[model samples]
Target: METDGNGSMEESRSKLLLYLKLAFLAMEPSNCLLSLAIEAGGGCITQQVQNFIVKECFAKNMKETTMNNQAYIKGILKKVIANVESSSVCAEDCLYEELAHYLTIGGPPEENNIIYREISFLSSDLDGKDCSNSVNLVAALRCSSNMLEGDTGCSLWPSSLFLSEVILSHPEMFSNKSCFEVGSGVGLVGIALSHVGASKVTLTDGDMSSLANMKANLELNKLCLDVASDPMHPCAQKVECRHLAWELASKAELQDQRPDIVLGADIIYNPECIPDLVRVFSILLDNDSFGEDKREAPSAYIATVIRNLDTFNYFLTVAGKSMLSVVDVTAKTQVPNLLPYMRSYDRSSVHLLRVSLLSE
Candidate 1:
């Protein structure tokens, strides 16, 4: 039996290699062989073929079709992500070779194009299965950091499950509103918002590395940042990457204007930053006053994979308390209570808590 098992493992490895070769041979420059690999139960095989094609593209004079093919392979990877349910095509160093070149070589500039991005969901490929249980939204966003943070599942706000659910549920919330995402790591949520027409979106993150990446992603997607500070310009919907730390988010930095929507993902994991996060919320939400203009008070959304429920609950409790206190401190409007703002929906270890001044 031991010998038989070893033989089976070797056979599986051989079949995988054979299928990978077939997939590579089948994928002509314009043909749909890429799709065939997906249909042939060749998720891993497709990945290998993709890697090879990427490398070949780089070796063969740094072609433009390589970038287009990168997008194509990404589409297949999305299918692979959906099929596998728990594997990551984004290996630690396995960037689509074509995109790596574009990032390093630079692409066409569009300082006047609309920028769209999504935060952590699945990799839009086979990786989606890993977070199948969480709520994800297809939020359109505007920012340059869309390309900055690509460390697979590491860093802040890296998953798209929760954000996708939000955008699908509340598309109108961002349709014409000016949206601003704090700590827009990789500009996922912010970019998705821009994709769906948020009117104007701003992606804010503190890391310079992430900001540079965001710019590359924006350029890759045919979006660009404006040279002047014109808010009403046609390309205002395009994403802008700027450095912003929650601790330093003051009137001087935010320009004293609260956004119609404020969003964060995976920001609640750190208990030490809770106070700073709350303070940033207070200042950005105009002291948490929904007032008569519920639209004006800045609807806030946060999505986190609840690896630790204690941390999740802690954030809910803190958000509730802070929002109520802001209400009392800002105005005498005794409109809605805080407990009602703390309703939650659960999905396994991943929990969705809607915390705001508005009663659901």
Candidate 2:
């Protein structure tokens, strides 16, 4: 059976543009992009497709595409043009010039790669219907380039992604609530909190560098940093970043925040940090209103990837000692798969734990 040429062509266009959007923003290498190009051109990189890529995709961010990591762009462009020329398709002069520019100013491997990730909360637009022509936009994050380094909050973890999805899916739980996040990496969850109308959002990180990076990300998203001082400003984000080393953080300081809700992402990896983390929870959950209304009891929603069972068990034991109830609500809470476009994010890898104070 032969498929209709027009139907096939539309499918090709949709996939090509969809892949290009992913490629231009948050892709790793050019392998997927390369395959998409060939597939879109009906088994070869046609001159039309070549012009589309060079003119449409790579032309957008000249500085980001050419600078900092000229070597990275140079390598990708080299392979792409080689494939095109091999297929007997005449490559464009603009592509040749772009290649020349990178080859002339090649440098060492890029320590930092600036990435713009566009997350969409599409419900059922998966069949290429209403997907290619336009995107149902969500938050666009300027992820830190320094995420390559180990042991830094500069990276975006799956737990954070899961937590963000949870916040977006269930805005009622956080709206008008004072929210505090421990181990807030890159401030993605804070941004989500702001989106969901959290009355106050305070993000804390132990690492100084990661805290600075998180501030930059918030600014990139146009979220106000110091909402307390800039209260009158229309763009006040009600989001602030703080240096909170769990081991050294004082109970007096945590008590001052008086957050109604506590959030954490991927903060359960280290056994050493469990004691301080549980202690921080205890202090944050300690509120005078508990005597009056049990409904006012603060809750901690922790999203973590259980890498080690023993380490997670240690957290449970410590939380129990601190009179905290840790319940696994990953199954009961049905959070919409908001981030269906991000291929790298695995929702199943993350587990959501609801923690609350237990009566003594």
Candidate 3:
């Protein structure tokens, strides 16, 4: 009985450690982290658990995301230490030392606030033995410190990450096709599209700051944007960045850009923007509007996290009224979770919708 109990305790510890690792990777909520720490400590944080939290979780986050919340992190550490001491468990020395260092030296400089993240996609050979080979895409993104300061468009959202995975997993779908992305925040999806050899890629955002940042990121990856030109012609440039506000975009302009595939990530939040967004989609998907040749209609892949039921339903209703068909193709078009290491990202929360024009 003693041996069995020890084995059970060891199993629980192992599971808790795994949970902590995942929570750190996914950048989960602070409350979730606190709960994980308590659970890992078996209701009372021990010296070893505190050491792990400081070394593995906190240190790793600081390095990866340039997280400079010294005060917030220090508070969490103090709470944990207090809990451990109150429970008569010893706390780790290194945890207190790190906290003291933060309280003294302060957080990272405001200028160096941006974080550079490396997203890797593992590739396997036919034998499936050499699965270690992977492709890495690096993105320079601003932290979500201030959503009101146009930071919302500069931050990398989870839906964008999921959409990037989809593009990489099924390169054939995008390769040799003309692709255009709406609300191209941080330009990760655009980068992925270019990686898969999309014939022509155009990334557009309503926010000028986001457009500028997106252009910088594309250049950082050694990709050049084509000279700004008429939207009617197929982009001769490898990648193009355009400032396009859906509310102000004209129907003629949207119809002029004959793209094979339209893409968007996390752009369906506001109810007020639904009508304009659907109008843009309708014009883009109507291939017949281009000429009498009657080419195959273009399809759109929109990756969204439905936070509000009413807003999502409103989008569906508006889209349907605009003669657009929206289908949930998430299961049918499932892609490999190439980013298994990204625990902070809840892949299950993202839903993929395929949108096209209804047969007329």
Ranking by TM-score: 2, 3, 1
Tens digit per residue, CA lDDT, model 3, 114-198: 5444455444221222222333444444344455665899887889988998998899999999899999988989889988899
Off by over 4 Å in 2: 1-12, 35-49, 62-66, 69-71, 82-94, 105-129, 132-151, 226-231, 235-237, 288-295
Model 2: per-residue Cα lDDT over 1-360, one tens digit each: 123688866775665666655554554457766876776676787777777777776665546444654555676788889998887788878788878876776454655555555454444335546664344335556555565556358777889989988887788999999899999978889988988789989999999878887888888777877667787755474778899999999878888888999999999999988999999999999876344544477889999999999999999999999899999999999887765435556899899999998986
Candidate 1 lands at a TM-score of: 0.51
Candidate 1: how large is its RMSD? 13.4
lDDT of each: 0.48, 0.77, 0.77
Once fitted onto the true fold, the runs of candidate 3 whose alpha carbons sit more than 4 angstroms away are: 1-113, 124-132, 148-150, 226-236, 292-294
Residues 73-187, model 1: lDDT tens digits = 4444444344334455443234444344445544345332223222222222222233223323222233332234343211324234346445544567678777777767656
The true-versus-predicted C-alpha distance at residue 286 of model 2, in Å, is: 3.4
Quickly count the clashes in candidate 1.
48
TM-score (all chains, Cα) for each model: 0.51, 0.81, 0.71
Which one wins on TM-score?
2
Query: What value does the lDDT take at residue 275 in candidate 3?
Result: 94
